[model samples]
Target chain A: MLLKLLIFPGFLFLFLCALFFDWVDRRMLARFQGRVGPPWYQPVADLIKLLAKEDILPTGVNPLTAAVLPMVSLAAVLTAGLYIPFGAFSTASFEGDLIVVLFLLSIPALAYFLAGWISTGVYSVLGGSRALLQYFSYEVPFLMALAGPAILAGSWSITHIVDYQSQTIWIALMQPLGFVLAIIGLIGKLKRDPLDIPKAKSEVVAGSLTEFSGRKLALWHLTMNMQTVVGIFLLVNLFMGQSSVFGPIPAFLSFGLKSVGILLLLSTASALYARLRIDQLATLGWRVLAPLALVQILVATWIGG
Target chain B: MASPLRSLAYLLPQLWRALKEGPHTVKYPFDPVELPAGYRGRVIIRAENCRGCSMCVRDCPAFALELEREGRDAYRLIYHPERCAYCGQCELSCNFDAISLSNEFVPGKPDRKDLGVVLVNKEG
Candidate 1:
């Protein structure tokens, strides 16, 4: 059990996957833009470089909170990964694990906001505020969109949802709108392009992370990268269904391939769109996506009944 | 036209083409770059062909060249690459076809003073 938690399907696995996925995301995005991307070991090299650098704290800042926020964020994301089933192996899967997973996934954003707000820099404060505002904007539609899968499956367990998908049809085929909304919400949650307003470099100078350096920044980066892996895994289980698409293929291998497909799709979307303004994102999220997600849930209910 | 979905439909094919074509950037330092004809680079001077008329020195816009006459037929041309604008005025002004710009570019050196090259030294 300790090996399961610490090695396979746990912290070590999630950390390695995070680094690999970050590299893949960058490579795909670079290819889309007609450029050569970083090498496979670039993420590992970057993390090590950041770790070896000097840690600097701003004047009048709480050093403990500044240090701990990124740790807490990374811990939350890692813990969330444990609940997510990776290739039919979840370290901790239980009833209502869906809700627990969602809540855990959200802590990083909150930690990010606090990281910005706690900093003495103007850019950090502004970035934190923007992150908070964007969080509220996307979180609603995201929750509502994910809810369609749970409601349609008639169980809150992600394993149950995956089981439901294998027996019936993929939820994505059943409710394409929800699938799209969930993807969009995942983009917002991950803060990719078209939704990366919080840390838009032109206006905010690395946004909430303006003041972060050394080990703290590395942890934050790890947290974000791991969050992407966790988010893609969740989407794969929720909408892409089980490993049935690759018949006779190992469950883990299919799960990995499907996750890469989602990563490529995410990278393509990131490459294709320009960043939206905060006001524009809020308007789209509430006025457009929220209603669309509600209609998706209604459609799912109609089909399920 | 204003819709993202419509825009995406148009952008995807272009992205596909770009991916197929590969990156436009060269490896640079690792690979030799092919320069074009008539590309102005470092100035070269032929000591044997020089008439010591000082036309090249007089017409130099950047004052990057100095012609010091040692005798009636002998002259030395000192070229300062740091001040050279690569305008090719000196090359054009040379009536004896003694000075011209070579196609070979000068690579950067750690010491700026070493950039100066004495292109001509002829003794009477």
Candidate 2:
């Protein structure tokens, strides 16, 4: 159990996957923009460099909150990682654990909000408010989108969802609207551009991250990347069918390829679109995505029954 | 709303083409760059043809050039890269054709001493 948690399908595995996935996203985005991206080791290099830098605490900021929030976020993501099945194995999972995973997934954003709120900078405050606003905007539809698969599989367990998909067809095909909505929600959840209003560089200077530097910032970045991996893992399992279609090796390959494909699609979207305004984001997430998610749930229910 | 959908349709094909084309960035440092014609870079001095003329020193907007007398009509031409704007004014001001710009754009040194170029006129 210790080995499983420390290594495969847990902290180390998920951490590496997060870094690699981030590299893939960056590389694909660079290719889309007709530029050579950083080398494969760039993420590792960035982490090391950030670690080597001096941690600067801004005035009026609670040092404990500033230092601890990133670790809390990282812990949330790593804990969520244990619930997400990798290839054919999950480090930790139980019946109705999907709800737990869903809750865990939001903790990082909450951490960001707290980190921002505890900071003295006006930009951090603005970023914190925006983060809260973004949380409200996307969380509902994201859960609703997840509901499509949960309903279709008749189980709230991720393993069962994958099992159901492997026996029949991927949920993505069965609930196409839900899949699309889920992907959109995933983009917003990950804070990618077009949905990255909180940390809009031009406006808020990294939003909630404006005050963090050195190791704290590195941990925060790692948390964000791990969230990306977790998000992609959830999407793949819920929609791309079970990874163990053939065997362990084939499962790993297919899972990797599908993850890359999804990452590329995300990178493409991020590259193509500009950042949405806070108002536009709210409208899109609530006015558009919420209704779409509802319709998908209705359709999924009818078809599932 | 429809416009965004329309633009997405337009964007998909372009994105596909871009992906197929692969990355457009040049592998700089590892691979040599093909600098465009008339590209102005670091200035080089031709000490043999130089007559210790200070026109370059006077005309330099960045004050990057200095001519120190080493002997009678002999001078040491010092180029300080820290101050150089790479505007090629020094290269243009040399009537003796003593200085010209090279296409090497990599400012590779961290130390200012490594960046400074000194040329001494031997037959002044």
Candidate 3:
């Protein structure tokens, strides 16, 4: 109990920072709209309210699966978060690699799919299907882009990737194609806006989260925010160095802020755009992005080789 | 397949607009939103024509309007703006036609007390 309590503050801090980024993104977008914007501390207020709200379980749903969905996603994320090399917070050297982190990121989607299907609704099933399909469409290009740095660094370890960037020029300059592809992949992973076909508000009514209310909705919502932070971290650590020293402050805060910028670009861009039809996303990925990524990889290797 | 690409092609203009245009999403608190036609805003009331007869108070389903005493014929109209359901029922049945809903649905309130619109009829 004591040990867990001690760990509590650290966990709270990570989550709070994650929530902070989400709030900042929203507020920034609100700023773009010429609004006063949410208070900087809005995410904290939202989470506190959520925690206090009662958890509503689905009636006669697979209790085990329903219980497990958020747990598995949260566990995988927290585990992956361990490997994420922020300035001072990144601790473990190599309990996992880039591939492992990438794969673990998918666990949330698995939990999401199960959550959708177990809810016993048509929209849930369709949404779950769309989610899985989205997984396949985007994961390939994303991995290839992720592999862009690995190709140069010649290692799968995220630390190695970051340390490699720290040694060399940032990967964004060397691999613009990879960077763009990776960002698109990141957007897909976050399931925001155009790629939010799974829970497309037009069709599925929050899709997987259709039946969830109160605290369950809140947990999923919070996790959604955390996922954006994680996605941004992966982008930063892979393409932008998290540990490079700056004037007085370690560049971790820079990572945090820039991640918010990328997320801001996403959320605003999303508000204006409509969701892509499922088939379009598939064809776009397979026909366009896959080829682009494969060629970039071939070219990067050739130039570097 | 064809349509999405087409849609993507169509969306290019919007992207171009975003790139070329200034920030169109007007800042909220510091800068106010431009209320276009059919702008759903808080209800505003004209104080004079309203008779002390409480049709608006009775007609309001959301209980957003209040007929309070300010002075003789100066009935204090406290409009709890947040309590407004935007149902427009209060706007419809104003027999004196003293009240009208504006397009300015800002939802701004420092507290529940601040949400009210207080007006009194004067014999001007």
Using DockQ as the measure, which candidate wins? 1
Instruction: Return whichever of 1 and 2 wins on DockQ.
Output: 1
**Candidate 3 local Cα displacement, residue A177, angstroms:** 0.2
State residue B78's C-alpha deviation in candidate 2, in Å. Answer: 4.4
lDDT of candidate 1 over B30-86, digit per residue (tens): 899878878999998787788778898899989999888888777778899888999
Give the residue spans of candidate 2 off by over 4 A: A243-245, B1-4, B34-37, B44-49, B67-79, B90-99, B102-108, B113-124
Candidate 3 TM-score versus the reference:
0.71
Model 3 lDDT tens row, A1-305:
33322242235545876778777767655554444457878887887887787777767688677766887787777666666766544556573478778888888887888888889777888888899999899989998988888877777788888777777788888898899899889888888877999999878888888877666667777777778777787888888764454642546567667666677767666755678999999998999999999998898788667
- The worst-scoring run of ten residues by lDDT in candidate 3 chain A lies at A1-10
Ranking by lDDT: 1, 2, 3
Per-candidate TM-scores read 0.91, 0.90, 0.71
Top candidate (lDDT) = 1
Q: Please list the residue runs of candidate 1 whose C-alpha ends up more than 4 Å from where it truly belongs after superposition.
A: A243-249, B1-5, B51-63, B66-76
What tens-digit string does per-residue lDDT give for candidate 2 at A1-305?
Answer: 99999988788898899889989989888887777888999999999999989999998888887888898889988888899887788877788888998899999888888888998899998998899899899888999999999999999999999999889988898888888888888888888877898899999999988888899999999999999999999999889876345987888878888988898878988988888888888998889999999998898889788
Classify candidate 2 by CAPRI docking class.
Answer: medium
- For model 2 the local lDDT of residue A224 reads 92
**TM-score-better candidate, 1 vs 2:** 1
Q: Name the lDDT value of residue A105 in candidate 3.
A: 87
True contacts kept of 1: 0.67
How many Å off is the CA of B1 in candidate 3?
A: 20
Ranking by DockQ: 1, 2, 3
